[model samples]
Target: MVDADQTFVIVGGGLAGAKAAETLRAEGFRGRVILISDERDHPYERPPLSKGYLLGAADRDSALVHEAAWYAAHDIELHLGQTVDALDTAGRTVRLGDDGTLVHYDKLLLATGAEPRRLDVPGTGLAGVHHLRRFAHAERLKGVLAALGRDNGHLLIAGAGWIGLEVAAAGRHYGAEVTVVEPAPTPLHGVLGPELGNVFAELHREHGVRFQFGAKLTEIVGQDGLVLAARTEDGEEHPAHAVLAAIGAAPRTALAEAAGLELAPREQGGGIAVDASLRTSDPHVFAAGDVAAFPHPLFGVRLRVEHWANALNGGPAAARAMLGQEVVHDRVPYFFSDQYDLGMEYSGWAPPGAYDQVVIRGDAGKREFIAFWMKDGRVLAGMNVNVWDVTPAIQDLIRGGATVDPDALSDPRVPLDALVP
Candidate 1:
C-alpha cells in the first residue's frame, strides 16, 4: 500500500511518466509526485512529431502532455532537462544530473523510454543527416522538409519502418522527391508480412516515392559536413539534400541495468523485465512504457511495445500496481498509422510466424481492407485499413477467444459479432 506521506519519483517525463502522475492523483494518492525528464520541454506526445507537427499542422504546445500550469495545479513536481545520474535502490535515492542533488523516494517508476538506433555508417554525423526522436529533432527536420519543398530537392530516407514511412509521406506532401531504402524483400515485411507490405509499397509508388528494396546503405556521403548523397551496397548512388535515418530504436536501459534490475531474455529484445503488474526485480521499483518488457497474458509471450497506446495504457496499469491494486497489464497490443490517404488500426498480438493464415475482408486494391491473422481457426490479430467503426468488434473477436470462419471473416456483409465463436 502507498503511504500518503511518502514521495513517488517518476523518471523519464514522457507520456508514460506523465500518465503515471495523472493516475496517482486520480487514484487519490496525496503523496509528493516528482516527474523528471532529460528534455527541456515538459512531457509531450511523440506521435505528432512525425505527422502534424512536422508538417506545420500542429505546434509544440499541441503535443505537450499538459500545459505548464497543469503540473503545478495538480501538485506534480516537473523536473525538466535534468537527468537522473544514478539510482541507489538500496539507499532509495536518485542522484540528479550536474547538480548532484539526491532525491529520496519511497517508490520509483522507471518510465525511461527508448532512443533512436544510431547509424554508424560514414557521414551520419553530417549536418543534414537527422534522426526523428525528440521535439528538437522534429524542429530541425521540419525546417529541412520546408527547404526541400522550396528547392524541389530529394530526401533520402534510410529504413522503411513506421517513422521512416510516415516521414516519407510528409516529405512527399511537401513536394520533395522521396526515396526510401529498405533491406527487406518488401517494406515492413518483417511485421506486416509480404502481402500487406506490398500494399504500402504500392501506395508509395503510386505517389511517386521511389523504393530500393533488398539493398543496404553502404555510406552516407557528405560535402562540407552536409549530406549530399547515399551509396547503396549494390553501388547505386541516390542524391539527397537531406537524410533521415528511421532504422528504429533501442530501449533506454542503462539505469536499470546499472541498478541490477532483471532484463528480459535476449530473444525478447533485452528490456527491463517486469511481471504482469509492472514491478521490477525490486518491489520498490517499477518500469513502464517502451522500456518495460512484460509478460503479455493474451499471447503467453513477452513483448516490449514501443507504440503510443502501450505507453498510454501501461502508465495507469503500472500506477495501479504500485498502489497494491490487483492489476494485470493484459490489454491487447494496438497501433495505428497514417500515410497519405491510408489510415490503419491494428489490434491484438501476432508474434512473428505465430499466425497460421490470414483472411482479408474488403478490397486491398481499393486500399480499404481488414486483414485477420488466425491460428487454429481462432482470430489472433486483425488490422483495418481505411475502415471505420470496427475496432471494438475486432478487439472483441481477439479477446473472446472466438473461432472465426475464413469465408465469413472475408465477407463484409457478415457482422463481426456473428463471427464470434
Candidate 2:
C-alpha cells in the first residue's frame, strides 16, 4: 500500500484533475499534490463555452471552480503548459514537456481526459475551421465569430452531438446562419437513442437551424486559406465559410498504454477501461471523467459519460478510492441542456436493447414534462424537458426503486409529487 505522506501527481487540469486535487485536500491528504496540465491556464469549467460564456451571459472569471487563492491556500501546486511526456511505472516518475522535468509520486491519478476527434478530410487544416475541446478552442471559434461580425458569417458544423448543437445555438444567437451536418440519420442516436434524438432534432429545426443529416463528407476544400465548402461522400457540395468539427472526443490514454496498464478494447469509442471504483488495471493509477469507461450497476454494462455531472462526480469518487476510502460511486447519470427556450434535465440509466416504455408525468408538448424509462417493473431512466419542478419527485422514485404508475403519472391534473413512494 502507498504511504500517505508521499507525493500525489495528477496529470491533466480539466474538470476531473482539478476536482481530484480538491478531493485530495478534502480527504485530509497532506502530501505534495501537483496538478500538471498541458493547458496554458489553470483549470476552468467547459459547460459555459456553448452557452453562457459564448453569449456573454458570463465571463471567464465567472466559471472558475474555485477562488483564485484557493489553490494557493490549499498548497496544491499548479503546473500550467506542462505536458507529461512519459510515465515510468518501475521508477514511479512522470516525465513532463520538452524539458524532461521528472517528478516522483507514490500514487498517481491519471485524469488525463480526452481530446476532440477531428475529421481527416482534405482542407481540414484551412483557416476558419475549428474544434471545441478547451477554452482556447472555443476562444478561437468565438474570435472568428467576433471578427466576422457574428451573423454575417456562414458557419458549417460537422457532427450533431451536444457540442455541435450547442455551438450551433451559440452561433444562431449571434445571428450566424448555422448548418449542422451529421452522417447519422438522427442526432445523438448513439446516446439517447433515435426516439429522443428526434425530439432534439425537431427542436433545432424549429429554431431555424438547418440540418444535413445522413450526409457524409468526402472533403473540406478551401480557397485563399479560408474554408469554402464541404464535398459530400455522394459528390454533393455545400458552401461552408466556417467549419466546426464536433465529431467526438477520444481518451488521451497514450501515457496509460505506455505504462503497461491493461486497456479496455475501445473499438466502440476509444475510452480507457476502468473498474467500478474508477481504478485502472494498474493499481497505482486511477482514471475518471471523460477518459474512463466505468462499469454501470444499473445498465449492466460499461459506460463512458461525457458531461459536467460525470466529471464533477467521478473525480471525487476516484479520489475516495485513492485515499483508501471505499466509495460506491453510484449516482443516477444526469445531464442538463439549456438552449433557446428550453431547460432539459435527464436522470437515471437505461438498459441496452430494452426499448419498452416512456411514461410522461406532464404535457410533453408544453413547457413542462417528465418522461420515465421503465423496464422490469422499475424506474430505470428519465428525461424532463422544462420540468425542473417534477425532477426531485422522479429522483426519489428512481432512488427508492419504485415503479411509477403510468396511468397516474400521465393524468393531466396529477402532480409529480404523486409519483413519490
Clashes of each: 0, 0
On TM-score, the candidate that comes out on top is 1
- Cα displacement (angstroms), candidate 1, residue 393, comes to 0.9
RMSD of each: 1.0, 2.2
| Candidate 1 residue runs with Cα over 4 Å from true position | none
Instruction: Compose the digit string of candidate 2's lDDT tens values, residues 198-250.
Output: 77787888877888888977788888998888878878787778899999888
Put down candidate 1 lDDT per residue, 107-220, tens digits, no spaces: 899999999998878888899889999999999999899899889999999999889999999999889999999999888776787768899999999998999999899899
**Cα-lDDT of candidate 2:** 0.80
lDDT of 2 at 197: 76
